[model samples]
Target chain A: MKWKLLFELFVVFFKIGPISFGGGYAMIPLIEREIIDKKKWIRSEEVSEVFAIAGTAPGAIAVNAAIFIGYRLAGFLGALAAMIGVLLPTTAIVMLLGSLYFLFKDNALVEGAFLGIRAAVVGLITYAGIKVARTSIIDKPTFILFFLILLSLLFLHLNPILAIFIGALAGILTMTAKKKIQQKREEKTHFQNKQIREISK
Target chain B: MILINLSLLFLFIGVISFGGGFAMIPVIEAEVTKRGWLTTSEYTDIIAVAGMAPGSIASNSATLVGYHVAGVPGAIVSSIAITFPSLILILLIAVSFNKINQSPLFHSIFYGLRPIVTGLILFAAIKFAISNGLIASTFSWQMVILLSIFALSLFVLLYYKAHPVLVILASGIVGAVIFS
Candidate 1:
C-alpha cells in the first residue's frame, strides 16, 4: 500500500508536469477533476483551502498543489518525491533543448512557431485574468480597486510591487472596518439585554 | 568571481517569479543586464529560446543562462534555487492552510491580492505582446489573417470549450500557411 501510494503520487504529478499548458493557473481545474473528484484523495473543502494557500503564497500554483497533494498522500519524503517527479520532465526537456538552442537559434521557422504560441499564450493569460477577476471581485470596492490598479500600471507606469502592497493594505483596512462595525453591533445588543434583565429584577 | 555572482543573479529569478515566467523578465533584465552578464539582445535571444522550449519558460531560461555564465554546476544551482522559493513556500502553506482558513485577516489579504494579481497578469500580457512583435509589426494582410485565427481560436475557446492544445496547434498551422 505504501509503494502504491508513492507510485500514484509520482504518476499523477509526472503526467501533470508536462501537459499543463497556460502555466500555473490553468492546471487548477484539471487537478481538481483528477485529485478531488476522480481519485478522492482529497475533499472539495480541502481543495479550496489548498487553492487559497497556493495562490496567496509564492511560487507557481501548480508546484504548490503538488506539494500540498504529495504531503497529504505521504509525508515529508512524499513532498520531495512529488517535487522531483513534477520537475523531472520539464528539466530533462529544458536541459536537452538548451544544449541545442544555438543550432536553430535563428531559424525563421522556429521563430514563426513561437510567434503563434505567443499569441495563444497572450489569450490564455487574458482569459485567466478575467476568470480570476470574475470570481474574486464581487463587491463595489473590489471592482473599483481592480480598475484603479489597471490604470496606475498602464498610465502612471507605477511599479507592480508597490501597487500590490497598496492594494493589500487597502484590503486589510476594509476588513478591519467591517469587523469593528460588527463588534459594535454585538456589544450594543448585549448591553440592551442586560438593561432589560436589570429592569425586570 | 563574476561568474559566481551570475549564478546568484539567476537564483533571484527563481525566488520572486510569481504570475508565471513572464513576470520574471523585468526583474531579470534589471539584475543581469546591470551586472553586464548578458546584453539586451542576448537576453532577448535567450527569451526566444525559452519560448520555444517545452518546459516552464522561467526555469528553462534560468538553466540555460546558468550554463552560459558558468557551467553544469551553475545550471544545477540556478535550477534548484529558482524552484526552491515555490517548493518551500508551498510546503509551509500546506502545513498551515487549515489553521489559516479560520483567520479573517488571511481572508482579507487574499481578497486584496486578487485584483492586484489580475492587474499584473494584464500588464504581463501587454509586455509580452509588445516584446513578441505583436504590437509594433505592420498591420498587413498577414496580420488580418492572424487576427482572424486569433478571433476564431478565442471563440472556439469561449463558446465551444475546445481543448487548448488543439487551438494552439491550429494557430501554428494557420501562422505557417499565412506568415510563410
Candidate 2:
C-alpha cells in the first residue's frame, strides 16, 4: 500500500465527523456521500463491503468506517489521521459538556432536570434493547439464550463479557447441533424408505 | 495509576463492544458499577450528556466517566484506550487482506453475539429502573414521576420514532421543571 497522503484523508474525516447526529449508523449515508459520491475515494459497490467490515469490527461504526476508507486511500498513517480527525471534534465537545455538567450539577434545577433525563434514559435504553431484540429473538432457542443471559447478568452477576462469550458459544453449538440432528433424521428416513420398498417388492 | 487502570479497562471494553452504541452500555455499566467508580445516577447522567453530544454515545460516556474520575488526562487516556482496540484490529485486517466479513465462522459468532447484546441492554434499563427508585418492592410518589417520564420517553421513541437527541433534550427540560 502507498504511504501517507494522510493530510487530505484527515481533513475529509474531520469534516465528516460532526455530521453524525443520531448515531454512527446515521452518519453512514454522509460517509457514502463523502467517500463515494463526492471524492470517489472507493468504488460504490465496495462501500457496502467497507460498512460490513466496519459493522463486524469492534467499536463505533463511524470510526471503523473512517479507518477502513483511510487505509484503503493512503496507508497506516492515513488510518491514524482519519481516526484522529473523526474523534477530535467529538472528544472536545464531550469534555466541554462534561465540564459544564460538573459545574452546574449541584444546582437544584440542574439536579431536577437530570432526574427526568435519567428516567428517560432508562426508557431510551430499553427502546434500543427492544429494537435489537426484534431481529435477534426470532426463534425458541434464541429466546432461551436471551432469557438465560439476562438471568445470568441480573442474578448470577456473571461477567458481562463472559456472558457475551457464552451467548456466542450457545449460538454456534445449538446451530451446529440442530444441523447434525436434521442430517441424521434425513438419513434414517432414507433407510426406512429403502426397507419399505424392498418389503413391497 | 488511575490512568493505567483507565487504559486497561477501556481497552477491554473497546474490544467487546460489538454491535456498538447502546449495545455496549451494560458492559460499561457492569465494569464501572463493579469498581464502584460512579454511582448509578452519576453514570446515568454521563450517558445523558453523551447522548446529547454528537458521535458515538459509548465513546462519549467513556470520556465523561474518565473525566469525572480523574480529570482531563483520565478522559484522554480512556478515550484513546476504548478506541485503540478497533483501530488496531481494522488496521491489521486492512493490511492482511483477510476476508472476515464473508466468512461463515464470523457470521455464526455474530448471530450468537447479537441476542446477548439485546439482553445486556435490557439489563441496563432494569438497573437504572431499580437504582433510581422507580421499581421498588413498595410504591412511592417518586415512582410515579419516574414511571411517567419513562413511559413518555418510550412512547416518543417507539411511536413517533423521534430522534434520540430530541428525546433527551425534552427529558432534560421535563426534569428541570419537575425536580425544580
Candidate 3:
C-alpha cells in the first residue's frame, strides 16, 4: 500500500510536469483539478492555501506545491517521489532539445518558431502578473507597495532579495503599529464605559 | 572545476530566487556571462531555448549551460543543485507549516511579499518584451504581428482560460505560418 501511494504520487506529478508550460502559476488550475476535483485527495480551500505557501517558498512554485501536497498525503518519501516525478519529464525533454538545438543552431525554421514563442511568453508573464496582482494588491497599502517595488526595480535596479527583505521588514513594522493602535482604542473604550457606569450608579 | 562552479552558482540562484523562474534570469545571465561559459548572444539563445522547452526556464537554462560546459554529469549536477535548496526549505516548511501559518508575523510578511512578487513578475515581462523586440524603438510589421500575438494569447488565457501548453503550441504554429 505504501509503495502504491508513492507510485501514485509520482504519476500525478509526471502528468503535470509536461503540460505545465508558461511557468509555475500556470500549473495551479491544473493541480486544483487533479488534486481536488478528480482525485479527491484534498479540498479546494486546502489547495489555495497550498498555493499561497508555495508562492512564498524559495523554489519554483510548481515544485513547492507538489512537495506540500505530497508531504501532506504521505510523508517525506512522498515528497521526494512527487518532486522527482514533476521534474523528470521536463528534464528529459530539455536534455533532448538542448542537444538538438546546438546541432541546429542556425536553422531558420527553429529560429522563426522561437520568434513567436518568445512573444507569447511575454504575454504569459503579463497574464501571470495580472493574476497575482488581483489577489495581492487588494488594499491601499499593498497597491502603494506594489508600485514602490516596481519603480525601485525598474529605476534604482534594486536586487530582488533586498526588495523581499524590505517588504518583510516593512510589513512587520506596519502591522505591529496597527495592532498597538487597535489595543489603545480598545483600552480607551473600556475606560469610558467604566466612567459611564460609575456616574449612573 | 566547472561542475563545482555550476553547482554552487545555481544553488545560490535557487536559494535567492524568491519570486520564481522569470525573476532568476538577470542573475543567471550575469553569473553565466561573468564565468565565460557562454557569450551574451549564446546566453540569449539559451533563454529562448529554455522558454520554448518544457520545464522551468531557470532549470532548463541551468541544464543546458551545464551540458555545454561539462557533459551529462554536469547537467545532472546543475539541475540537482538548483532544485536542492528549495526541496530542503519546503520540507522544513511542510513539517512546521501549522506553526508558521498561525503566526501573525508570517501573515504580515506574506501580505507585503505578495505585491512585491507581483511587481517582480511584471518587471520580468517588460524586460522580456523589450529584449524580444515586441517593444522596440521603431515600429515595424514584425512588431505589429508580435503585439497581436501577445494580445491574442492574453485574451485566450484570461477569457477562454485555455491551457498554457495549448497556447504555446498554437503560438508556435502561428510563428511557423507567419515568420516562416
**Candidate of highest TM-score:** 2
Model 1 pairs in collision: B14-B82
Q: Can you write out model 2's per-residue Cα lDDT over B109-134, one digit (the tens) per residue?
A: 77788889899999999988888877
Each model's lDDT comes to: 0.68, 0.86, 0.81
State the DockQ of every prediction.
0.42, 0.78, 0.56
Off by over 4 Å in 3: A1-12, A22-56, A69-75, A184-201, B19-22, B25-54, B68-71
Candidate whose DockQ is highest:
2
Q: Could you give me the TM-score of model 1 versus the true structure?
A: 0.74
Candidate with the larger lDDT of 1 and 3: 3
DockQ of 2: 0.78
Model 2 misplacement above 4 A? A1-4, B95-98
Top-lDDT candidate index? 2
In model 2, what lDDT does residue A17 have? 84
Give stretches of model 1 more than 4 Å off: A1-12, A23-56, A97-102, A178-201, B1-75, B136-146
TM-score of each: 0.74, 0.95, 0.81
